[model samples]
Target: MVGRGRPPPPPQVARDEGIRPRRRNMEDEENMYGKLKFNMPKFKGEDDAEAYLSWALKVDKIFRIHNYSGAKKVAMASLEFEDYANTWWEQVVTLREEKGDPPIDTWEDMKEEMQARFVPTHYKTDLFNKLQKLKQGTKTVEEFFKEMELTMMRANIQESENQTIARFFNGLNYPIKKIVEFQQYSNMVELVHQASKAERQVNEDIKYSKSKQMIRGGLWTPPPQDRQALLVVQ
Candidate 1:
């Protein structure tokens, strides 16, 4: 019976094996944290609402890309705070403790807290006003579309697909809008696509007209104040 079984590993070998997995896990965590910190955007508690919104958007993107848990997302984002932002976070933690409220552990909760502190109450109203007045102006169709989309997002607008399409269509330049208005579109994507095509066609038409003008100009031989000189050369 004694000869049938193998002896256990030495104490040192057992300890080394036990430490290896833990060491690997620690290294992995460190590497992940390093990457998160590297990619995270720093916030300095600016008075500008748009700046805060922009930082929030960038941080949200980074968290989504990493698939971070709520708690981890909050933790990683807090690390990127700077100057007044860092002080604000510290005050938030203290205030929660004083009120006996649990620390903010979710990304959504953290965002709300930050927005309340950083974004002015008038920010959304201003953004909405700007959106209402937004027009294609001199911007390209794509640029105008992007501005509209960003404004809508910042304003936290919620609307049906048809409504959004209508808004976008209405903002288009008159030429493009007139052409696109006749087309049927079921969604914003289709509307944008049609508008873009119309824009290209409009641009081509303008180019063609300009080219024709240039050709006409080049072909004209000034009705010669020198008709006599012209006749002599002939």
Candidate 2:
């Protein structure tokens, strides 16, 4: 063949010797997370499970559980107070508020203090009896909560406890999807004191449904005079 001297051996063989791995292509690899976009949040309707979940989250965040949901209320209230109660007393132990220095740091310090400190007392007793009605199965979690003392909101439990309860309920597989009202997942938190012991300053008998802010620290004073409106802890 008079073409080219060695005629390029074979296209494949020639290419192999000349080609290198096209250099690792770092550019493509560096880009991973994709684009960010702005979007509005969404809210589910009354029957939607998301709605209940949203309510549950709201409930879990509150400090007190005077809600209509009986033992459930007590449980939630208790859970709310637990961590705060631990830290609050630790601050008190130093006795002197001089430097505002933290006195306790370790888990052991907390544990010892917990044993030494008395749990705060409560005033509400009937909330327990009201909760017991659940055993009769005559009413749903929603209904019992709705019927109980002063208006109430849903309450949540600790994460580990919450998951455990969720697993238990899910195991039951009790036609929960069909029932409009039920506790799909939740844990119980008990109260540190009698419900009555927790006081709000309002002289007016504003039900939980009526009250916008659940003020736990003594009587409420209105307007510019009320520091709560302006105060941001951070």
Q: Which stretches of candidate 1 lie over 4 Å from their true place?
A: 1-38, 65-69, 218-234
Q: Candidate 1, which ten residues in sequence have the lowest lDDT sum?
A: 218-227
How well is each residue in 206-234 modelled by candidate 1, as lDDT tens digits? Answer: 87876787688754343457567878889
Question: Which candidate number maximizes TM-score?
Answer: 1
TM-scores for the candidates:
0.72, 0.18
Predicted structure with the largest lDDT when compared to the true one: 1
Q: Which residue pairs overlap in candidate 1's backbone?
A: none
In candidate 2, position 45 carries an lDDT of: 21
Candidate models: Cα lDDT each: 0.87, 0.35
Error of 2 at 210 (Å): 33
Candidate 2: tens digits of C-alpha lDDT, residues 1-234: 556665545545655554444433443333321232212222222333334345444544441322234444433323344344535543565563566766554433433444344322221233334333322134443333334312121222224655433332332213332231232222322110111112121113345524545366535555564566557532
RMSD vs true structure, all candidates:
10.6, 22.3
